[model samples]
Target: MPSPARAAAFAAAARTILAVTLAVLLAMAGGALAADAPAGKAGPEKAANASAAGSGDDEDEDDDEDEDEDEDDEDDYEGMPPGDGRDEVFAYCSACHSMKLVTQQGLTRADWAEVLVYMVEEHEMAEIEPEDEKLVLDYLARFYGRDRRARKMGR
Candidate 1:
């Protein structure tokens, strides 16, 4: 029969081998995910290339079209309307989800405030600064408020 010390050493070695194998498997899985990711997904090299490509193209109309395409590629908050607090709302909300999730809502200002609180408490979203929170609430209430029919009719 094997001695206790020998068995312990064998067990330890087996565990070490298992851990190394698991680590290698995890690394391969991560590599596969990265390979499958879309080409335009965020990367430092892609950002530098986008900006550099757009900078020198101001002299030609065709270049302007190319620049617009580049801008569209980088546009994360495409559906949100232009407004005073649009940037603040987009920067905060789009970190976790698509801007369409926000644009489809038609809540009053108080309900919008409640949603923000719910996001922070339930979904672990970061709390907005007080000033920025006010701006975001104002923007949401104005553009996505409950009187959607009225606003559309006016337009």
Candidate 2:
């Protein structure tokens, strides 16, 4: 058998190897999560202003022009059905991207829930209140659901 001191040294070395292995695994998991994280914070206005402020006045003017175009695009949702959560979806969802994107999707209620979770986790959307979440899900599942699209398209 090995000497007592040699056995103790071997045990210590095994522990050291195990610790280093765990540290590397944890670091790799952290890197993966960071990679999946959104590009930046939630607010488009803040991001826009920060970039504009970093550049000169000419770029600021260009940003204003871009805002004007965004306003024009916002009109695309004018025909959205008026109801309990219409305003909530319009305000929250459109803050990041166009409402056209919202209109284009025909997801189930479960899928919409998953989308909300994705928005919060991956895209940094604010956590919505439970009541408002229900309203939004109801509206989306009623009006923008796969069944409705299927009926409309005769699929």
Candidate 3:
């Protein structure tokens, strides 16, 4: 039987070995996941821009057709109702996330204001200019407000 001090030392060494093994396993798993991930997947902003700019390919004729298609797609706002501040809302919100995420919400004006504030404060979103903020709020309230259900039902 080992002395208590030797036993404690063995236990400590075993813990160290276990920790190192876990760390190595975690690292290998992470690397494997990264390797398996699709090459076409990208961050939100990059994906949006890539979709807009078309696939970067060597075919020159296809590139010209893509450019024309991109021009037409520029005005497409992904189902956000057309309104006075549609451009501002699209430019700001779509920079970080899909416009579908924005259009699906049916919050009141105050709730929308709170969400914008939360996004800026917690998510490090760029602060909207005061004039643009007002326009965005108004546009959201008009088209996507809580009353949207009633309006849609009536329509």
Residue pairs with backbone overlap in model 2: none
lDDT of 2 at 66: 70
Tell me the whole-model lDDT of each prediction, alpha carbons only: 0.76, 0.73, 0.76
Q: Model 2 off-target regions past 4 Å?
A: 1-76
- lDDT tens digits by residue: candidate 1, 1-155: 99999999999999999999999999999999897543334533454465578676356468777667656543634555556676677767766887778888889999999999999999999889998899899999998888973576675
Give, for candidate 1, the lowest lDDT window spanning 10 residues.
Answer: 38-47
- Specify the highest-TM-score model's number: 1
The TM-scores, one per candidate, come to: 0.51, 0.50, 0.50
Sum up the clashes in candidate 1.
0
lDDT of 2 by residue, 1-155 (tens): 99999999999999999999999999999999786433223333443454467566554366777767456433434445545566567656866886668887899999999999999999999888898799889888887899978987899
Query: In candidate 3, what are the lDDT values of residues 62-91, reduced to their tens digit?
Result: 677766755544436665654567667777
Runs with alpha carbons beyond 4 Å of true place in candidate 1 = 1-76, 149-155
Clashing pairs in 3: none
Global lDDT of model 3: 0.76
- Root-mean-square deviation (CA) per prediction: 7.1, 10.5, 8.5
Candidate with better TM-score, 1 vs 2? 1
